[model samples]
Target: MVKHLIDEQINLNLLTPEKTLFTGEVSMVVIPAEEGELGVLPKHAPFATTLRAGEVKIYHNDNVSDVFTISGGFAEIVNNKCEIVADGILL
Candidate 1:
């Protein structure tokens, strides 16, 4: 069970051409995609994916949470970190 568990920290960065909109650490992330929603956790497999215009849910420590609407963008998950480069972002 311990070996199967991914017990690493995760950070998310939501950015646009103008500036970075949101940046924080979280336990999980849910992104809207063309096919369906994708969930990511710590130490997840490296991936580069397209994100659809929808809500991006972030689950932080202490049960805190935040949601943002992204028009469209790309998401990359690697080395326990997730970075999102989007065109439009609204919180």
Candidate 2:
């Protein structure tokens, strides 16, 4: 059996006690950072960083996509997986 790769998009609410904003597969993701925007792709290195209030771009395939704004939060990357825990999210 072959182990398939699974890509996931994670969103959360910081204000709420426990709220899952969004979770699914995405072609690409752009995270807003203090320095600027950061792009994430498959097999990305393990990383952890803080996010600023700004637009988060979610790319599905080539033409399909969506954008959301996050107040603030933390993001972690490990094992080719990306996880984002945010305060507030708006799309």
CA lDDT of every candidate: 0.80, 0.66
Candidate 1, residue 90: how far the Cα is off, in Å: 4.9
Indicate the TM-score of model 2. 0.74
lDDT (Cα, tens digit) per residue for candidate 2, span 3-91: 23233433322232367655776656788876788887666777789989898777664443667788877777676566777777755
Clash pairs detected, candidate 1: none
Best candidate (score: TM-score) = 1
Number of clashes found in candidate 1: 0
> What would the TM-scores of all predictions be?
0.82, 0.74
Residue-level lDDT of model 1, residues 1-91, one tens digit each, is 1333334458899888999877877777888876789888778899999988998888754343878898989999998889998879765
